[model samples]
Target: MWRAIFRKKLFIAIMTAQFMIFAFDTTTRADDVSIGFLYTIPTLMGFLIIERGLQITIVVLSITLILTGCFFPVPIETDLLVFFANRVLSIITVLITGIMVNYRVRMEQTLGDALAKERKASAMQRAFVSMVSHEFRTPLTIIDGEAYRMGKVKQAVSPEDLQTRVKSIRQAVSRMIVLIERILYTSRAFDNKISMHLERVNLWTLLKSIGRQHSEVALSHQIKVNVHDLPVSIRADRNLVTYILDNLIGNAIKYSPEGSVVEVTGQTNGTMAVIAVRDQGIGIPEADLPNLFEPYYRGGNVAGISGSGVGLYLVETFVRMHGGRILVESVEGQGSVFTVQMPVAGAEPAPAVSTGESSFPDKQ
Candidate 1:
């Protein structure tokens, strides 16, 4: 109950602060800036605790009243009303500021919790990937040595047996490489270390190329790969887009049952290109869907699936890097759709973006 009340107050206060900040301009400042300055000093000082905020507010406001006495020629009645109204405004602003500060603290605490969980999962994944690589690498090395040495043996090795073991080593190495790269890619994306090498590329052609790479995964699951229809062109970092799609399609196959459908759809809407990966895989929970794009956040139903949980994280980061948004629609136990919307280079948004108001002057 306490938390609920705090959140409601915080929301109202922050919104009000935002409204004031956006609305106040030097040209539009019908109210005196000194009054604005005095009113905000209290709220700023009062950010953390009601008691502390109120104390600082009072101190600052008192100083303002004293300073104005020396600088301005004011009548007694007008001065009284100004003091009364300013005091009321300061009280409201302080409460609002305290709420906003508290709400942010709560949000950060929640983010920390989620990050800690993800870190634990990543640690476990790192351990598993490490142990498996070490375990498999030893055997693979032995097999590879045996295969190479067999050719020099006085007794001839059956070409069939030699070929089989070599094939197994190759497969193991491929799996290890894939797991290692996925984790690494996720790390870079989360850290915002990915640098774009942007170029104008045909989206249809690109999808077709990436689609072919996943053909085997699709064939194994009896899922069709469709890239015949897509936006003809888009401007993006080609390699990043490829990585995004590869991870997305791989995950879809990894989660879906055999014979389930996996579809890739793309089209240009206004100034953005939307690429969606729709899968009839085990769906995500409604509650868990919001965190899907968070780094290392694995879905509840995907606990047993094969993933490092960085696919969607990298996907979202890459899309956002290009000035776009990603969205998801999923139903637990039904299926999931991951959508990537990328705005075209040099395109303007249709709607005017609105900013919030603050009592303080703009910092920049």
Candidate 2:
């Protein structure tokens, strides 16, 4: 803030000095003595103004002042030719100075932008490392705890208790597998190496399958699917579509309170297929809506939740890859509805690139 105030003051001072120079050249100078070149001082100072429009205005103003100064009185013995040449040279000097200043400003802006991106990438890398460490540790700790408990039991454990312990361990392992796959998919998406195997897929069947998978794991949350108006089939990459829905449904379950209903609805809008996942979760904050899909950006409200923050990023990326768009609506405490719309006939096939990974994993 202080820097901005100083810059504004400096700009005003420069403009004041510029006008004083023009006054001196037009009113106080003898005709033969050409000090029109002094206008270049203000033109050089224009580097302080980052706006291109303002820079161009300053250049034009300097040239105008130089030309106007030419009309003032001169000494009776002055050589008209020399005076005319001097004025032209002064104009050229100001123009060149303005050009150089503008070029320098542009270079500085570009360099600044590049540096900012590098800083943001570095910050995100640190966040990714921290998030992965925490996410992995939770499940590992759970698995270890279960094992330790079973081993310490002195009496014969009941079959039901043994089965329950095994289920807990398997769930922990499954959570780890999902985390690893999400990271892999995020990397592949960033590299633009995900290849689409486009085929005709039944929308209703796909939603039902994904709903079932999430339902089994998130037994506390009820999953509902309504697809009566949805297009029967869409030509798309089945696996990518599955990932998109899976992430959306999974997130809805993860963020919402226990026993909340997560409704998956679909409809047809002209040639586009529209699907929406509505969750009675802690809705996102208004400030986070715009950047919700940025990689590794979690909502400020989800402090204790276990998430790598790449789910929505990948969802949006995959949706766009299939030439679809996603939209979201939410209130702070009510809920969020994520809507996705895509052409029934999928996008043109992307150029095949080897991602060096197998197809999306099957549910365990």
Candidate 3:
């Protein structure tokens, strides 16, 4: 409430109204220039309330000019020298007040901006810690279970059983490694340090590799690849493309039922390479769809699910880094589909991407 009173527009309006009130006070015995001292309020407001220095200077000068004209028409009761001196002193006071107010406002604005940025950084840090703790649990559990089973066998476990436990441990370790890498990448993204090194990449080969890895890591979910229409290659940052594909497929598996088939399709659309991932999962609500890719935002339906809500955020970031866009379509309790479009290799080199609102496809 107090801040609103100090806003430049409101402050200016109040000061102007006050000056008008003074101008109409017909019972005043003061000299005209003394009444014109009311102009000082606007000059002080221009410096203390407005953000643009040049604009405030113009407003103060206009107010001074108007007040001078109003005073010129009034007859002075004192000697001419005294009248001139008084007006000069009032003008000097206005200028000095304006200068001091401007300096104070500038310093306050700088301090406020710094404090706001610090608060935002602190919030990100808290989210990062929570995500790390949540995401590491599954892998750590897997490793712990495998270790426990091996210890229980007490040298009587078969060679095949030991090997199976070892493989599970390795898989768990791989998952932990990937989770850590994502945390690091997300931190860099917050700092806007994401750098892309584009190159010609084979689409078929990349999709196949991602499918194989998903199948190996998530044995319960199956990934189906459909790249019959995709070009052999496209210009992109190979690592970024892999990151995008990995997150989409991983999210599909994480959200879907066991044995559900997640479809990965790639094709060429105009000069762009389009990749779509569709899953038979509990879909997002209409309200949640808009916030799906927001950092640390999880859907209402995912209350019991194990997720940090960073996968889609990372996917969106990586796609934009390739100068691409992502689209999502979902119906609650039915399924969800995510489509990514990137400029194809040999087409015009894509411009650097910007952080903007995501667009969703119209539901059928």
What TM-score would every model get versus the actual structure?
0.59, 0.81, 0.69
* Residue-level lDDT tens digits of model 1 in 238-257: 66677677777777777888
* Model 2 weakest 10-residue run by lDDT: 26-35
Q: Let me know the TM-score candidate 3 reaches against the reference structure.
A: 0.69
Residue 152: error of model 2 in Å? Answer: 2.5
The global C-alpha lDDT for each of the candidates, from Candidate 1 onward, is 0.63, 0.82, 0.73
Please provide, for model 2 over 81-133, each residue's C-alpha lDDT reduced to its tens digit, 9 standing for 90 to 100. 66666656665665677677677878988999999999999999998899899
RMSD of 1: 12.4
Alpha-carbon runs more than 4 Å astray in model 2: 1-78, 350-359
Ranked by TM-score, top first: 2, 3, 1
TM-score for candidate 1 = 0.59
Supply the global lDDT for candidate 1: 0.63
Per-residue accuracy of model 3 over 1-364 as CA lDDT, tens digit each? 7787567567666665654443332113224565657656764665565556554555465556546555654454655555555555665675678678877878888999999989977886787788788778888999999877777764587888779888889878977877666677776776766666667899899899889888987898888998988988888766777778877888888888998989998888988888899999998999999988877778989987877667788888878767779999999888899999988853244454323322211111
List pairs with backbone clashes in candidate 3.
Answer: 235-345
- Number of the top-ranking candidate, with lDDT as the measure: 2
Q: What is the lDDT of residue 63 in candidate 2?
A: 59
